[model samples]
Target chain A: MSLFKNDSDFKMDVLREVGNIGAGNAATALSTLLNKPVDMAVPTVSLLPFEAIAERVGGSEAVVIAIFLRVDGDAPGNMFFIINREPARRILQGLLGFDAAENDNYSELELSALSEIGNILAGSYLTSLADFTGLHMSPTVPSLAVDMAGAILSYGLLQFGTMGDDALLIDTTFLEGQQEAEGHFFLIPDPESFDKLFRALGVPL
Target chain B: MTEGTLIKVGMADLNIADGGAMLRTTGLGSCVGLTLYDPHLKLGGMAHIMLPSSDIAREGQLNIAKYADTAVPELLQRMISKGAVTGRLLAKMAGGAQMFAFMGGTDTMRIGPRNVEATKLALERFEIPLVSEDTGGNYGRTVELNSLTGVFSIRSVQHGVKEI
Candidate 1:
């Protein structure tokens, strides 16, 4: 069974627009931080199984650096800011003026810097979403993790786990200039919160 | 296909393997990959348990394999029906990890450790000895069990591969 089983095409479009607005705002914030033009891809909204969600990044065991924050309040949810290693290096070098390390091991300073970056970008994303929906949504303190994408993404699926194996996700990819993707913003609202979201946006659910 | 096939277990799923087949589960974090091996019968069962108990489940239909309390007995019953001796079975598990550290008293934040504890208590109820484990870390792990040898292998990015 799927959450959007009875939803119309118009509803999906509204959700996609929701993703676009939030990510667009976050992209602007990131562009300002790096002093470089940041481009965002059209957001993808999908209801996928746990394994396939990990495949969106790379694979189950693909190592990634991620920042996680739990959204609390009117429309509670889970949010993740994910970045691959290479782009993360570029981000560090560009924003923090530090040489990219030769190895994967990151010092505490680097991790903290990455966490703060995620914090700022996620804050912008949520602020825009709150303004758009007129729902009070706030992100908790951000936490950083350097681990497998599947492991980190699965944390966001725990709420959906109770209902079924598949969870809905709104994912937006951020690009640095015209280069490859630099990061991703994943928003997974709790299942029950979807009703409030649709109602807030005047979309009949 | 060869008898020693590798059978995969997905998240919140479970299965039993024999005839020299290997049982494996991948990308486990905050979920416990609990396995029971009976060397005498060359039988093994694995469960990718996601929650600590089924009592809190509000789902209309319950998935037994998704909860620690339910998955343990279900796996045990599967192994027993496969002609495996319950007295000789040994348990080995991995992949209950606090992937993100959070400062709070929320039960959801402590699910990883709670899963480990619940799995342990479930095994204790059956008097099954937990021979080995690699648990409670801020990382993800993939675990595989060889049915013939009853050797459990744990693989992670931070720590390479270790056999228990």
Candidate 2:
């Protein structure tokens, strides 16, 4: 009775719309923080079988920064924020105005700042998503990492779910003046979370 | 005839020389390659940072040269010690690419872009103008910087060879 059955395209379209709202919120937050107008591209969202995630992002040799979150309440779900490491660091540096010759070591202060930045961006984005979908949810504390393709992929796969289930990933870019940053938003729901989301979205039980 | 001197920079070693050193690296993917040259002192330095921060690196491996967060400072300090003045220095950077395209979803693996951004920030903080850079592609780049002339070359799978 649910049109959701075998409707991958429909699912992708719904997720893209959700992503657009989320990115808009993130851009607004970023603009306020930097005191500059921030323009974000419309998000590109895809729903892939978990098995394909590793292959999709792992083809290149670049650093990855991933933030994981758990969304709960009426529609329980899991979410992740992924970005290329260079963009993450650039965003941090741009925000802080730190120089190249300054101490390259990241003190707890700097790391904390970075984490807070990620939290703000991801939080605003996901909150807007929940509003659009008529669900109530909040994000978890942000996490950061700098690692190879294999290490990042393995970590995400292990932490989220097995390879068979479908994973939703949303890609977007943040642009302000000459600075640009790109990131991915991934949602992989566990069995319970998946059920909650379906119920909240008014999908047939 | 000028002798081409080879300086092999280990994890945290900052190599700086005046008028005659050739700094080189074999395999560079996500790590950063930074070159700073002081015109007045005729001195130059290069550092290869493997990660973003030394604080997060493994124990017993807490060296300034091992991470971008530490290597940039150490490199500048070493250059200063070698009679290179900070105000007269100019910086050039390369490397930091997602060599493989498969790891798309996770944020933890995006270190290449981070390294480049971190390095740029460090340079800017030091008031060092970034004269040139080649960063953030989907391919690995091997770079060679000539300390004496401040000229560098980047060789990658996609872009054959170009001077920066």
Candidate 3:
């Protein structure tokens, strides 16, 4: 709660730019992977209650494919790349020559390929943020899961849960050719990380 | 069977129901969904525990239902206030899942198992029996408990549906 003592509009604008630079790079990476132009939405920084965070993607029961990466350097945080089922299938069909599985069960190869894509995007996101802020931010090995949105997203909220019922996150959407929402990029920096992040960016605490 | 109210328990939340009501918590991953039921009174309580202990909590106003250590006692006291006997209370639990696994994992990464262990320990401290449990998988689960029948149902993506 005290992290954003002021919760100032100026602070939110700073976070928006941070999300912009990070997810913009990630969208570019996804575009190169699919060899198509990918459009991105303006990043939104919100301090949402725990339940509402999951609702952003869908309800608690909404099944989705999530790639989780633990950012492990200065200004540590949690990064998630979440994709809906049908869009994931489309991505698989477009990128690889294999027909995507029709059911929830994904072949091991398919899962690996999806994880690799997530790793590439998350890596690029962190790299860009690192360069822009001059903070050494790196990601651990990315982990992938196809499960309920609440469950997957909750992992990123544990740190905030310790602080309060609310969590602050920067959310960005990735769109494919038709402007259909293809994926979401969620950046939930740990409660303690915000101070370091703002300090690094020359924003007064 | 007559229709009963369905109480939705959100993340880091808890509730108690009586008669034929159902207590449900959805999409529990690396979080434990622990329930307390008194068959004689047909009363039930559910807690969606996100962490093992409140000792690590830094929140100014601690959410008792958010931690395994605190949720158990709070649920028990609520049941008691509603005239449910402690001796008649038993526990059934599900949803301590390792949703994602890293190569070299840390303690926080193993939170699912820790939550299960802490919930069980809390029940132990209260001298309640853990009759059945469905826990510790690499999957997310939605769990529900029927207060009237004392039946616990666990639903997951990989595992269709089963009762504990």
Candidate 4:
């Protein structure tokens, strides 16, 4: 039931490039905000089951800070900025000058601040993508949630659920210095949006 | 503590448990975790229903466990074949939370309520009594159903754990 069953290796490469460009711009935006270097790994595009998507972040029960935005326009999709608890705390400390609590509970102000950071990065990601493909893409007002990666990410998979249990996602991991991954950008275009996206990028559908 | 095997139900998947096994599913947001239990047989079944209906399915082959309308009947049939009676079966469900609230809601954002509604309708068609439900919030839930005790325990980060 894969939508990309007829898709070629070249199409996946194009999607990888899409993830690369979008995440590159977003990494640059984060570096500017933190006044430190932010590095990104090569984006990986995968067609995975709903269960496996959570495993990438850790597991189904792994608590995470997720900033979600609905991509609106010609190439509509779902975008998520996911970070673990520790890295999220570091981000708050570095950007807002406030030390996060040792516990997982986040204050109202902290949640709002993190939401804004997600908003900015998602905006840059879409802007660069729009420019690259010559497509009209924009993001709605971003929302923030601190919960299990599976729950937060499942929201992005509803559109694909009707088609199948698996979804195709373009994932990019962000690294802070030489340490492990600090965060990730998951770009899940809706099942219907793929044709439009490939067409917009001059790939035959 | 009642010691038993834990049978896991994954996203858009369903399974049945018996012989004192506990059926569990995790991280349910906007997706309904519907369960059917026969207190007499101590047989339990759970489905992580992700969508309202399969009528709109574009896939060549539909996954019956992924939709509310389809999963309900399939779960019941499996339970019935395993010596559970439909007339004596009772239902309990959780999850179906709107994890994030948007300003102007779309059909996608309203999937939680839609899934709940579709599941209820399917249950009514089967004449299964929905004994209790914990649903419709802005949070995610992880639920477990004890086949031995018939207690559905729901755990969430905000409200801790409760049994129904």
Instruction: Tell me candidate 2's fraction of native contacts, as a decimal between 0 and 1.
Output: 0.00
Question: In model 1, where do residues sit more than 4 Å from their true spots?
Answer: B1-4
Query: DockQ for each candidate?
Result: 0.70, 0.02, 0.85, 0.81
TM-score-sorted candidate list, best first? 3, 4, 1, 2
lDDT of 4 by residue, B88-136 (tens): 9999999889999999899999999999999999999999999999999
Model 4 agreement with the true structure over A11-114: per-residue lDDT tens digits: 89999999999999999999999999999999999999999999999988888899999999998999999987898899889877878846987888889989
Write down the worst ten-residue block by lDDT for model 1 chain A.
A1-10
DockQ ranking from best to worst?
3, 4, 1, 2
* Alpha-carbon deviation at B128 in model 3, angstroms: 0.6
Give a tens-digit lDDT track for model 2, residues A57-161: 443234455565555466555556666556556666777787411333455666667667778888898788777767777765555544433334433332222
lDDT by residue for model 3 (A88-110), tens: 99889887887796776789888
DockQ of 2: 0.02
On DockQ, the leading prediction is: 3
Compared with the true structure, what per-residue lDDT tens digits does model 1 show for residues B1-164? 24779999988999999878999888899999999999888888999999899887777778899999999999999888888887999999998899888877378888899999999999999999999999999899999998888899999988899999
Model 3 chain B, poorest ten-residue lDDT window?
B1-10
- lDDT, each prediction: 0.90, 0.63, 0.92, 0.92
Which consecutive 10 residues in model 1 chain B have the weakest lDDT in total? B101-110
Please list the residue runs of candidate 3 whose C-alpha ends up more than 4 Å from where it truly belongs after superposition: none
